[model samples]
Target: MDDKKIVRAWIAYDWANSAFATTIMAAVMPIYFISVAGGTDGSWSFTQTAAAIVVALLSPLLGAIADHSGKKVLFLRVFTVIGAAASVGLAFVGPGDMWLASIIVVIGMVGFGAGNTFYDALLNDITSPEQREKVSSLGYAMGYLGGGLLLAVNLGMILGWESLGLPDKTAASQISFVSVGIWWFVFSLPLFKKIKDPQSTNKSRIGEHLKIGVQRLGETFSRLKKYPELLKFMVAYWFFFDGINTIIVMAASYGTTIGIEETDLITALLITQFIGFPATMLFGKLADRLGSKKMLYSSLVTYLIIVLLGYFMTSSLHFYLLACLVGLVQGGSQATSRAIFSKLIPPGKTAEFNGFLSFTSRFFSFGGPLVFGLVKLISDSSRIALLAVAFFFLMGILLLTFVNLAKGEKEAVQP
Candidate 1:
C-alpha cells in the first residue's frame, strides 16, 4: 500500500478500537459495573488494577515474540478478537453479577491493553521520524473522534431506551456493550487487511519463539543502561501514563459512587468525546510547533490541576467541567509520550522495546488504581482517592525534566 493509505489504515485502527476505550473502559461499562452490576466502591478500581497486572505480565513476552516472528498484525488481530468477544460477554451481566462483570472486564482490558503493544510498535513501521508526532497525534485525535461518535450513538440509545422499546437503562447499557464489541471488531478490519505482517528469516515455532522472547526481554533490560535518555523518559512515562489511565478507567465509577446522576455522567463524558476530537488535533499541531516534550509538560500540569479540583467536586457540573479538562489533554499527553518514545528506540527493535515500555508502564500502572482503591477503601472518602493521582503527575514532571530529547535522539541513532 502507498504511504498515505498505510497511514490512513493505521489511523483507522485507533478509531475502530476506541469504541472500547471510550464506552467500555472509560464511560459506559464503568457506570454499569457500579450501579447495575452491584460493584462496590472499590471493585471497579480493583478490576482495573487486576487487568493492568495481567497485561503487564503478558505484553513484553507477546511483543518480543511478535517482533521475532514478524507477526505484529497477527498478534494484533488475535487480541482484538479476544477483547471484542469479552466485550460482547458483558451484555450477559446484570444486577448482582459483579463477579461476572469484573471477570469479563478484566478479560476485555487485557485484550485491549496487550493488543495495543503491537499497535504502538507498528507506529515505527508506518511513519517516518519527521512525521511521527503529527501521525501519533492524528491517531489519537481520530480515536477521540471515533470513540466519541459511537459514545454519542450509545448515549442516544441509553437515554432513549424507553422510546426504543428497551426494558430499562440496564438493558440499554447492555446493548451498548454489545455495540462496542461489534464496533471494535468491524472497524479493525481496515488495518488487518491493509497492514501486511513483516516476513522474518527467523521464523520459529511457538516454543522457540517463547524462548527467544525471554532472551530478548532479558537482553533489552540489560541494554537499557546504554540508552539512559530512553530509560529516563520511560520512567517519566510510567508515572504520568499511570495517572492518565487510572483517571480514564476510574472516573465514571467515581462519579457514580459519588452520587452523580447517570445521565449527567454519560453526558459529561460525551462532552469530553466531542471536545477531545478537535482539542487533540489542535494539541498535535501545537506539539509540531512547540515541541512534544513541552506539550507533554503542559498536559501533565493540566492533569495535576484536574486532580486537585476533583477533590472538591460535588455536582454534575463539576463532573462535566473535569471531563472537559480531561478531554483537552488526555490524548495529547499520551500521543506525545508515544511519539517521543518512538524516537528513542533503535531500529528493528520496535516491538520488543515497545513491549518493555508497555511492561513497565502497565506494571507500574497498577499502583495508581491500587492507591486510588486503597485510599478510597481506607479513608472512606472518594475525594481523597481522587487527590492521590496528583502525586504521579508531579513525579512525572520532575522526572521528565531530566530527559534531554536531543540527547535521546542522538543515542538512538548510535550503533
Candidate 2:
C-alpha cells in the first residue's frame, strides 16, 4: 500500500464532496431557497442542518459496519452516488416548490455528510501516524483549491444569469445545483479507482458485521474511559470545530442579514478557500516542527482574534480582511487537530474514535445557529453571533491546555 496513492484518493474525495459545501450549502442553495423558491424563513436552513445531524448520528454504526465488513470504499461509492443524484435533482425544483428544494437539499446533505465518515475513516488505514496531518491537510487544501475553481465558474454563470442562456435566475440556480452533482460524481470516480477497501480487522461475514455494528458501537461508547485523552480531545474538537463549522455556515448569512452584498460575500468565501490551500500546508509543516499542541493553540488564538475583529467589521473591505484572516488559520487548525487525534488513537479503533469524535463535533453544531439566531433576535445584531462563536474557541483552548500531547500518546498505545 503506497502512501501517495492513498493521499491522492483522500484528496480526491475532498474535492468531490466540496462541491456540496461550496456550491450547495455555502454558496447558491441558501440564496436560491430563500429568494427563488420563496422559503419564508430559516426552515430550509434548519432542515439542511437536520439532515447533516441525522447522518452524523448514524455515522458510528455505519463506520463500525464498514470496519467489520471491510466495506468503507463501497459505502463511499454508494453515498456519493446518492448525493450526486440529489444534487442533480435540485435543477428540477421549480417556482412554487420550496418544499421540493428543501427535500433535495436534505437528501444531498445526508449523502454528502454520511459519505464523509467512511472517507475520513479510510485515513486510518492509509497513512502512518507521523504522516496523518500532512496527508489530511493535503486533502483539505486540494478541496479548497478545486472547490474554489469550480465555484468561480458557477458564480460567474450565476451572477451573469441572462447571458448564460439559462431561463431565469431560478433556472440558473437549478443548473448550478446539477453541475455540482456532475462535478462531485465525476471527480469521485478517481478515488474509487485508486483506493481499495480498507482491510477489516474483524473476520465477520457481512450479515454478522451488520449485527456487530450495533454491538461495536455500544462497546465503543462503554470503553471511552480507556482513552481519556482521546475523549478529552473529542470534547475539545466538538467545541472548537463546531464553532468553525457554524461560523462558516452562518457568516455569509449573517452578512446578508445585515445588508452585505452577495457578490462580496461569495468572493470573500472564495478567497478564504483559496487562501486556505497553501496556508494549511504551511501550518502542517509548522505543526510538525513546533508540535501539534502549540500549532493548535496558535490557531485558536488566531480564531479568537478574527471573531473579535469581526465585531467591528461593518464594511465589505473589512469582511474581505476577515476572510483573509480565516484563510490563515481555518484549514491549518482543522488539519492539525485531525492529525493530532489520528496520532493519538489506537490503530484498530481509529474509526470508532473518529466516529465518536464526529458525532460529538456535529452535536455541537445545532446550537450555534440557534444561539446566533437568538442573538440576532434579542439584540437585533449579527455582531453578537460573531462574538458568540468565540466562546467555543475559549472553551476549546481551555480544554486543550489541559491536554499533554506526548503523554496522551504514550497512554493510548502503551502496549
Candidate 3:
C-alpha cells in the first residue's frame, strides 16, 4: 500500500469513530441518559464503568488473537458494525427506558473501546517511527474536524427542531442518535476498502486460535518485567489517561449538574471540537521539535490547570473557557501518549501490546468516574467531585518521571 493512502485510511477511521465520541459519549447521550431517562449522574457514571470493565477484561485476549491471525481488520469491522448498530438502536429508546438505554450503551461502548485497540495497533503498519507522532496527531485533528462537523449539524437539528417540523427537542435528540450511526458507517467505508492488512500464515481453526490467544496473553503478562519502561509508561498512562477519559465522559453531565444550560454545554463542546483540530496539528509539529515527552508533560500541566478551573466554574462563560483549554491539550496529550507507547512495543507484537495498554488504561479508567460519582454523592457538590479528579493527573505526572524513554525506544528496535 502507498504510505499516504495507508495514513489517510487510518486517519479516516478516526474521523468515522469520533462521531461516537462526540455525540454519544461526550455530548448528547449523557444528557439524554440523565434528563430523558430519569437517571442520575452517578448511574450514568456506573454504567460507563461497567462497560469499560468488560472491555478491559476482553481487550488483551482479543488483541492477541487478532495479532496471531493477522485479522486486525476483521475484528475492527466486527466491532464497528456492532457499535454502529447499537447506536442506531439507541434512537428507538423512549422516556423511562433507562434499563434499555443502559444495555444498548454498554454494547456500543464495548464495541467502540475494543475496536480502538486494533485501530491503535495499526499505527505500526501505517507509519514509520519517525512519523508516528505527526501521523497520530493528524488522526486526532481529523477526528476533531469530522466529529465537530456532525455535532454542529446535530446541534442545529436540536435547536431548530420546530422549524424542521419535529415535535420537540427530545425528538431531535433521539434522531441525532440515528444520524451518528449512519455517519459512522458511511465514513468507515474508506478504511475498509483502502487499508491493507499485514499477511500471516497462522490461519488456524477458530478453536485453535482461541487457545493460542489465551496462551499468548498469559505469556505477555508474565514477561512484563522484560520491558520495564513500557510497564512504567502503562502505569502512568493509567492515571493520567483515566483522568482525561473521565473528563471527556463527564464534562457535559457536570455542566448540566452545575446549572449550566444544555445549549451552553453543547456549544462549549462544539468549541472544543473545532479548536482541537488546529491544536492537535500544532502539537504534532511541537512533538517533532520539543520531543513527545515534553509535549506530553505540557499537556498534563494544562489538564491540571483545567481541573482546578473546573472547581471554580460557575457560568456558561467559565465553561466555554475551560472547554477551549481542554481542546488545546486533549488531543495533544492523547496522541503524544499513543506515539510514545508505539515506540516502546516490539513491531510484530503491536496488537497484543496495544491491547495490554488498553487493558490497563481502561481498567483504571473505571475508577476515575466511579470515584467522581462517589465524591458527588457524598459531598452533594459536583465542584468538589470535579476537583477530586486532579489527583489522578498529579499521580500520573509523578509516575511518568520514572520512565526512561531512551531505553524503551532502544528495546523496541531490538528483534
Candidate 4:
C-alpha cells in the first residue's frame, strides 16, 4: 500500500480502539466500578496498577519476538481481540462484583496497552520521519473525536436508560461496555485488512523466536549506553506520561470525592475530548514550525499549572476549566512524545525499541497512582495527592531539557 493509504488505515486503528480508552479506561468504567461494582476506595487505581504490571512484563519480550518474527500486525490483532472480548465480558459485572470487574479490567487493559506497543511501532513503517509529527498528531486528533463521540452517545444512553426501556442506569452502563467491544472490533477492520506487517530481518525459525527474543531484549538493555538520547527521552516520558495517565484514570473519582456530581464529571470529560480534537491538530502544526521539543516543554509547563489549579478546585466549574486545560495539552504532549521516540529508535529495531519504551513507561506508570493514593492516605486530602503529581511533570521537564533531538536522530541512523 502507498504511504497515504497506509497512514489512513493506521490512523483508523486509533479511532477504532479509543472507545475502550474513553468509555472503559477513562470515562465510564472507572465510575461504574466505584458506584455499581461496590469497589473499595483506591480499588480502581489498584486494578490499573495490576494491568500496567502485566503489560510491562509482556511488552519488551513480545516486541522482541515480533521484530524477529515479523508479526507486529498479528500481535496487534490478537491483543485487540483480547481487549474487545474483555470489554464484552464487562457486561456481566454487576453490584458487588468488584473482583470480577477488576479481573476483566486487567485483561482489557493488557489488551489495549499491549496492542498499542505494536500499533505504535507501525508508525515508522507507515510514514517517513518528516511526516511523523503531523501524522501522529492526526492519529490522536482522530482518536479524541472518535472516542468523544462514542462517549457522548453512551452518556446519553446511560442517563436516559429508563426512557430507552432499559431496566436502570446499570443496564445501560452494561450495554455501553458491550458497545465499546463491538465498536472497537468493527472499526478495527480497516487497519486489519489494509496494513501488512513489515518484513522480518532475522527470519529465525519459529522455535527459536522465544530464545532470540530474550537475547535481543538483553542486548538492547546492554547497549542502552549507545543511545543516550533515547534513554534520556524514555526516562522523561516515563515520569510525565505516568502523571498524565494517573490523572486520566483518577480524575472522575476525584471529582466525585470533591462533591461534584457524576453527570457533571462525565460532561466535563466530554468537553475535554472535543476540545482535544482541535487542539491536538493545532499542536501538530505548531510542533512542525516551532519544534517538537519546544512544544513538549510548553505542554509540560501547562500541565504543572493545571496540577496546581486542580489542588484548589472546589466546584464543578473549576473541574470544567481544568478539564479544558488538560484537553489543550494532553493529546499534543503525547503525540509529540511518540514522534520524538520514533525518531530516536533505530530503523530495523523499531518494535524492540518501542517495546523497551513501553516497558519503562508502563512499569513506572504505577508510581503516579501509587503516589496519589499514598498522599491521599497520609494526609486524607485528595488535593495534596493531586499536588504530588506536579513532581513528575517537573522532573519530566528537567529531564527533557537534556534531550538533543538532532543528535538523537543522527545516532538512530547509525548501523
Candidate 5:
C-alpha cells in the first residue's frame, strides 16, 4: 500500500474503536450500569480497575509475541473482534444484570486496551519520524469526530425515543450498544485491508514464541537502567495518563452523584468530543512547530486546571465547562505522548516496547480511580475525590521536567 493509504487505514482504526471509548466507557454504559444494574459510582471505578489489571498483565506478553512473530495485524484483528463482539453482547443485558454486565464490560475493555497496544506500535511502521506527531494527532482527531458523530445520533435516539418508536430510554441505550459494535466492525475493514505487516526474521512456533516473549520481556525490564530518559517519560506518562483515564471513565458517574442530569452529562460529553476533534488537529500543528515535549507540558498544566475546575463544579453548565476544558488538552496530551514514545523505542521492538508502555500506563492507572473511589467512600464526596486527582498531574509534571528528550532520541538512533 501507498503511504497515504497506510496512514489513512491506521487512522481509521482510531475512528473505528473510539465509538467504544465514547459510548461504552464515557457516556452510555456507565449510566446504564448504574440505573439498570443498581451499581454505585465506586463499583464503576472498580470495574475499570479490574479490567485494567487484567490487560496490564497480558499486554506485554502479547505484544512481545506479536513483535517476534511479525503478526501485529493478526493480534489487532483478534482483539478488535473480541471487543466488538462483547459490545454487541452488551445490548442483551437487562435490569439487575450487574454481574453479566461487568463481565462483558471487562472482556470488551481488555480487547480495547490490548488492541490499542498493537495499533500504537503500528505508528512506527506506517509513518516517518517527521510525520508521526501529525499522523498520531490526526488519528486522535478522527477518533473525536467519529465518536462524537455516533454519540450525537445515540443521544437523539435516547432523547427522542418516543418519536423514534423505541419503547423507552433503556431500550434506546441498549440499541446504542449494537450501533457502536457495528460502527467499530465496519470502519475497521480499511485497516485490515490496507496496512501491511513489518517484515521480521524471527518466525518461531506458538510455543517457542511464548517462551521467547517471556524471556524478552524479562530482559527488557532488566535493561531499563540503560534507557533512563525513556523510563522517566514512561513513569511521567503513567501518572498523568492515569488521571486522564480516570476522568474519562468516571466523569459520567461522578456527574450523576453530583445531581447533574443524564441528558446534560451526555450533552457535555458530546460537546467535548466535537471540540476535541479540531483542537487535537491544532495541537498537532503546534507540536510540529514547538516540539512534542513542550506541547505535552502545556497539556499537563491545562489538566491541572481542569482537575481544579472539577473540584468546584456544581451545575450542568459547570460540568459542560469542565468537559470543554478537558477537550482542549486530552487528545493533545495523549497523541504527543505516543509520538514521543515512538521516537524512543528500540528498532525491531516497537510492539514489545509499546506493550511495556501499555503495561505501565495500565498498571499504575489502577491507582487514580481506586484512589478516587476510596476517597469518595471515606469522605462521602466526589468533590474531594476530584481534588485528590490533581496530585497525579502535579507529580507527572515534576517527573516530566527531568526527562531529556534529546538523550532519549539519541539512544533510539544508536545501532
Candidate 6:
C-alpha cells in the first residue's frame, strides 16, 4: 500500500469516530450524567468511578484476547455497534428516569472502552516501523478535528431542539446521545470498508481463544524478566496515563462543579479537540526528528504545568485556559505513547500485546475516576481532586527513565 493512502485512511479512522469521544463522552455526557442522574453529588461521582473500575478490569482481558486472536477490526466493529445502539437508546430515557439513563451511559461507555482494544491494535497494521510517530500523531490530529466537527453539529442540535420538535430539555438532551450513534455509525463505516483486519494465526476454538489468551497473557507477563525495558515502559505508560486519563474523564465534571456553565464546558472541550489536532501533527514531526522519548518528556512537562495550574483556576475563564493548555498536549502525549509502545511490543502479538497494554490503561483509568470521586468526596474541591493525578504522572516519568527506547524499537521491528 502507498504510505500516504494508508496513512490518510488511518487518520480518517480518528476523524470519523472521534465525535463519540468529543461530544458524547467528554462534552455532553458529564452534564447529562449530572442532570439525568439528579445531582452532581459525591455519590454520582462515585458511581462514575465504579463504572470506570468495571471497564478497567474487563478491558485488558478483552484486549489480550483480541491480540492473541488478531480480531482488532472485528472487535472494534462489535463494540462500536453496541455503543452506538446504547447511545441512541439514551435518547429515550426521560429526565425523570435518571437511573435508567445512568445504566445506559455505563453500558455505552463500557462498549466504547471495550472497542478500543482493537482500535489501538490497528496501530501496527496502518504504520510502518519508521512512521509510527507520524502515523500515530495523524490519528490523534484527525480525532481532534473530527471530534470538534461533530460537537459543533451536536451543539446546534442541543440548542435548537424546539424547532427540531423535541418536547422539553430532557428530550433535547437525549438527542445528544442519539447523535453519538448516528455519528459513530456513519463515520465508522469508512474504516470497516477501508481498513483490513490483521490476520490471526490463532486458529483455535472459542474455548481455545480463551485458554490461549489467558495462557499467553501469563507468558507475556513472565517475559518481563527477560524484557525488563518493555515491562518498564508498560508501567511508565500506565502511571502517567492514569493522570492523563483522570484529566480527560474529569475535566468537564470539575469545570461544572466549579461553576462553569454547561456551554462553557462545551466550548472548552471544543478547544481541546481542535487545539489537539495540530498539536498532534506538530508532535509527530517533532518526535520523528527528536526521538519519541524526548517528545514524550516535553508532553509530560506540559501536562504537569496544566495540572499545576488547575490547582488555582477560579472561574470559567480559568477553565477555558486550562482546557486550551490540556488540548495542546493531550493528544500529542497520548498518541506518542501509543507510538512508543508500538515500537516495543513483541511482533506477531500486536493484538495480544496491545491488548495487555490497553488492559493496563483501562485498569488505571478505573482508578483515576474513582479516586477523583473520592477526593471530591473528602475535600469537596475539584482542584484538590485533580492535583492527585500529578502524583501518578510523576511515578510514570520516573519509571520511564529505566526503559530503553532504542531496545524497544529494535524488538518491535523483529519478525
Q: Candidate 2's residue-wise lDDT over 15-115, tens digit each? A: 88888888888888877788877886578766776787788787787887876677788988999999999999998887778888887888888888778
Regions of candidate 2 where Cα sits further than 4 Å from its true position: 198-207
Candidate 1 whole-model C-alpha lDDT, 0 to 1: 0.90
By TM-score, the best candidate is 4
Model 5 lDDT per residue over 155-267, tens place: 78987999998899999999999999999999999999998675778667899999999999998898677788989999998899988988886787788889999778878
Q: How well does candidate 6 match the true structure in TM-score terms?
A: 0.90
lDDT of 2 at 95: 75
Residue-level lDDT of model 1, residues 220-291, one tens digit each, is 999999999999999989899889988986787788788899788778888887788888889989999999
Q: Tens digit of lDDT per residue, candidate 4, span 36-79?
A: 99996578868977998999989999999998888999999999
Residue range with the least summed lDDT across 10 consecutive positions in model 2: 197-206
Off by over 4 Å in 5: 38-42, 199-203, 373-381
Candidate 3: Cα lDDT at 63: 94
Error of 3 at 408 (Å): 0.4
lDDT tens digits, residue span 1-415, model 6: 3367656766776786687777666667666767775646465556566666767666666666777677778888888898889889887875566677677777887777777667877878877778888888988998899889888877887788788887766677777778778888887876787787656566788788788778877887777566567888988888888888888767766776778887787788788888988888998999999988988888888888888998888888888888888888889998888888887877767767776776667666666777777897899877888887788878877888888888866765555
Model 2 TM-score, all chains together = 0.94
Count of backbone collisions within predicted model 4:
0
User: Ten-residue segment with the worst summed lDDT in candidate 4?
Assistant: 198-207
Q: In order, what is each prediction's RMSD in angstroms?
A: 2.3, 2.0, 2.0, 1.9, 2.0, 2.7
Q: TM-scores of the models, in the given order? A: 0.92, 0.94, 0.94, 0.95, 0.94, 0.90
Model 4 residue 386 CA deviation in Å: 2.1
Q: Which ten residues in a row have the lowest lDDT in candidate 1?
A: 197-206
lDDT of each: 0.90, 0.82, 0.90, 0.92, 0.90, 0.78
